[model samples]
Target: LPTSSSSEDFHESSSSESSDGTSGTPTLEPVPSPVPEPLCWEM
Candidate 1:
């Protein structure tokens, strides 16, 4: 029972971490693109 509980906790943490990483990538990509777009527009 204890092992199963621990496994569940581990799985939850792993899933959350994976989700965070996936989200972080998209946010970072948009940030750089916006920065370049304004510069390109001004130029």
Candidate 2:
């Protein structure tokens, strides 16, 4: 966890933000990519 914490710190360094509304990073929702339909064979 410590390593992860350090990595998070590094990320924070690269990123400008604070726990308090400082970052203003947009909250983006994940959108699913369209999947191709499988081919159907007639019996």
lDDT for residue 42 in candidate 2, whole number 0-100: 25
Model 2 over residues 1-43: C-alpha lDDT tens digits?
A: 9999999998776444544474434321122222222222221
Q: Score each candidate by Cα lDDT.
A: 0.75, 0.48
Q: Considering summed lDDT, which 10 consecutive residues are worst modelled in model 2?
A: 27-36
Residue-level error in angstroms, candidate 1, position 1 = 1.3
Give a tens-digit lDDT track for model 1, residues 17-37: 656557755755678788999
RMSD of 1: 10.4
Q: Compare the candidates by lDDT and give the number of the best one.
A: 1
Q: Which residue pairs in candidate 2 collide?
A: none
